[model samples]
Target: MGGDFGPRVTVPAAIDALRRHPSLRILLVGRQEQIDPLLSHCTSIELDRLAVVHADSVVAMDEKPALALRRRKDSSMYLALQAVADGRAHACVSAGNTGALMVLGRGILQTLPGIDRPAITSAVPTVNGHCYMLDLGANVDCTASHLLQFAIMGSVMVRAVENIDRPRVGLLNIGAEEIKGNEQVRLASRLLAEQKQLNYVGFVEGDGVFSGRADLVVCDGFVGNIALKSSEGLARLISRKLRRSFGLNLYRRLLALLARPVLQELQAQLDPGRRNGASLLGLQGIVVKSHGGANRSCFGYALDQAVSEAQMNVPERISEQLELDLQSRDGSVKTF
Candidate 1:
């Protein structure tokens, strides 16, 4: 109900996911009138695995998080999160107001033990498969401790979801040197390096993120958000420039025709839709945030991400890892 296309996109995407995963069950939390019309498009088999829990109101895309939490208690986003908090669903996926989702998710699900706040994490395509980056905009300002927490959680997430036994973690910094970056980053790097459990690979510059220098990159939300958005904008700019270049002349047109398959493969590899879901890690329950403007296929990818995380038991894994780390330290380390 909160995405750009609302039920028109989500309903179909949910059905598509159900078809892909036969054991998957979906509880569509939205107004019946709006959701029922879309249900007609689903097959009988698809309908059997789907259920609609009526939520008469919706939190608008631009709505303030505080207002959504205070006034929109009956909203689809609220109920969907409540379902996860209530254990009725393993995870909640929403292409809704991101701020609202973060606020509501933290309020409902609560943070895992030793975690002060949840970080928004997502897989960024790299020269080598992909790398997970965290604090994508959950907390604009963070202390060194927060960054350390993100590194620990991100390492656990990548290891569980990507099947890396000892995922390498890096601090996103302006330069590779220990003398570079702000005081917060320098402190975070020192803290990360001290952790024997993590494969702390020191600082990784902006370009190193896609270079696959590390399996997980950690930073404060302000820096992480800027980096993520800048990469997205650059991807779009490059794609547009390539399309224009291919259409400039007859020779170029012919060249483009000859290179069509290769270009298509490259585009598919770089497509943001293929990596649409960003997990709100550190929370006790699973919540995946999709791009608000995502189409049905993109939304389906977000649903797939949710399913994957749920299957991996990511939150539990993180909690257990933290507990083990704390015990190993003889409870001297701070929980934040």
Candidate 2:
């Protein structure tokens, strides 16, 4: 059990997923008593496709990662990931403590060969469609090397998941000029440029993220997290203003009715629930981290993401790409 609503939300989401994908199976890893009650209404077919693995405890949302790693080995989050590592599950999805999940995921699944650490990446809506951005909250402090690694993984992910032939990679910076960013970004820019494997499109500003100027934007978690949150806040502000403007008077209300179809389509296009899962890339196994406050529909989207990643064998693809890149180089690329 994890997240704000725990099994109450996740159980229904899992049931709904089972309904949608006839071949899908789910392992509900949590306290048996808490999880079982939520499943009482599941159909026989849904019950047949789902199993509950008991977890001794639950990790608190605010628990320190290190402490949870050391003391809460039997927590639901840990057990779910362990299932993946043990080959009992193809992927693990969690809406628990992000820090704890990252720590536990890296420790249990291990990083892919040549990857220093796992970076959190997700698809962000762009003018063209969407692009993946990484280091969302995984590595707040990163070296130039780390940024380069993120770029490689993010590019590979987009190519595999989005089916882009050669995705354009951009380094997030204050300006498009090579001379703008600090030492780390500039160095990372040079590294990315040298890699013929990557389609480096030079520096991208904050606004360039949504402009669809690049297929992937690479940065340390500190910058990426702030940018993501700011974008979310701006979206909420614009939505609120639109609603207020539409209800200002009878004339405005009439206008809103006429514009309802267009507004509905726009809302659907920008729904956060449609893109709920954040992939922890570079891990040896698939692990999708869902937002902790997610409702049933949003959690269902996270489950769908996990299924997609598992089917694509994302970890293996990244590993193969990195190996090819390493051998193609003149002994310059780093591996851990």
Candidate 3:
């Protein structure tokens, strides 16, 4: 992993991962000194299954992806991906520089054929249950056709991971009516509405995200990213307010005793770990992204999500469904 804190942060997360997923084999890629002690922490970790590839380069959170990727040949993120491309590992994941990671991932792993552009997508928890939002921060500026493809990809993803049958898709816009928003959203709405393979639920306002109306929400990366961060911030703010309320006064404290169950449930509802782990969906291999600020529990959840995606063969399923659905419409590529 190309981590900012190197071994100090990764080692503990690694130990927790091993406890949670004994089947998880790690290729620890960092400065040897930084990673060696981490391996030592886990006495139960099978030394044979674990390996290290030394990489001295680390990408800063704000570095230019293209420049860093071009210059940093020995970066840990680069090596982790190389391991996948070389068939040394089945998948690669990083919680480092997201921008750099995206650049290196596409450069090394390449996009799936017929995909307009690989999107950095993640499933977020909805009030009803769970749904996915795509291009969370990958492509901020997207075309009408790109949004259509995102809707298709997001639908396939919800199917593979969440087992949703005929997932309802919504185009993110200023208003619920099809007449609202920019030309891109308007045009994308048309394409999505016409897609016989998709369950297009029509234009959804931003408020509908938490309203649990759509199983898949598609939008330009900038808006989606803003939504993700804003939601996370709101969850935190709400949690703090509840905690403050619980600790306020004598009668309030007595009331808080009665409200404990409700508070706990609300807390769990807002916790990021309970929500779906962020995923780099369009990559060649399954890449589950944890929050950069993830705790050991969150990292563990991400590891579980990765294992589940790998077992489900989500990437292949997505590719298969996409080819069949797109080809069926074009009538060029035969699909079974």
Candidate 4:
């Protein structure tokens, strides 16, 4: 009962995930009437692995986060997270109101020890495979401490999920020069460098994000959100131009036909759908936010992200790393 297609897309994606992961179980928390009709075609085995816990309402896409948190306790988004908090579910995945999800997630599941706020982190296609970027519209006005927390959480996440040891961390900035960015970035840079556990490589420019200069890039939500949206728009523009250019004439059409496999591979590599989930890092429980406009396959990827985070015990690992790094600091900055 969230996103553009509601149960129409989510149900099939959930079923497909169940098919792909034999050990997975899904609880469809939504209005039973709307969800039941969509599942009429599910087989008995699929039904056995799936259950529907009726929710009285849903958080609207544009609903105010605070208001929804205060009033819409029975909404599908709220209930889904409640399932995670109650230990009935390992993780919660939603393509609903992002603000509402964050507010309710923090309220119920709570943030990890020593974490002030949860940052939204996701992968973007890079010269390497991809690099994780954080604070993508979670907190627009982040403190230097907040940025440090984001880096720690992102480094932990990359190590756990990507199995990379000593993942390089970079603070997103205007330039590599020491005097390029504002005070927050500069302070965050110094703070990051002091952490011996982090392989901090100093500042990274916007262009460096995809150059594989660093495995994790941290920034305030204002800049990170704009950068992500701009990248997405540019990717769309490039794809459209490619399609139009190849269909211009019979000669180009023949060329496109011959190059279909190559084009398909390129598309697969850059497809945003392949990286649809954005983890709300720093939270005590696993909560993944799917794009509100995501399709069935894209939503399934979000589910996969939640499952992976849960299996890896991301929150515990992050908390442990934070304690180790923050404790080692000589009380100059109060992280905990």
Model 4 worst lDDT run, 10 consecutive residues: 327-336
Report the number of the highest-TM-score candidate.
Answer: 1
- Superposition error at 191 for model 2 (Å): 1.1
Model 1 TM-score (2 dp): 0.96
Model 1: clashing residue pairs?
none
* Alpha carbon deviation, residue 14, candidate 3 (Å): 3.4
Model 1 clash tally, residue pairs: 0
Provide the lDDT at 283 for model 3: 71
lDDT of 3 by residue, 175-267 (tens): 987678999999988878877889999987878887888998999999999988998888788878977977889999999999888978877
CA deviation > 4 Å runs, candidate 3: 1-6, 43-45, 243-261, 331-336
lDDT of 2 by residue, 139-231 (tens): 889989899889888898888777789999999999888789999999999888988989999999999999999999999999999999999
Show model 2 residue runs off by greater than 4 Å: 330-336
Q: What is the C-alpha RMSD of each candidate to the true structure, in Å?
A: 1.5, 1.8, 3.2, 1.9
Clashing pairs for model 2 are none
- Lowest summed lDDT window (length 10), candidate 1: 327-336
Q: Number of clashing pairs, model 4?
A: 0
Name the candidate, 1 or 4, with the larger TM-score value. 1
The ten-residue window of minimal lDDT in model 2 covers 327-336
> Candidate 2 local accuracy as lDDT?
0.91
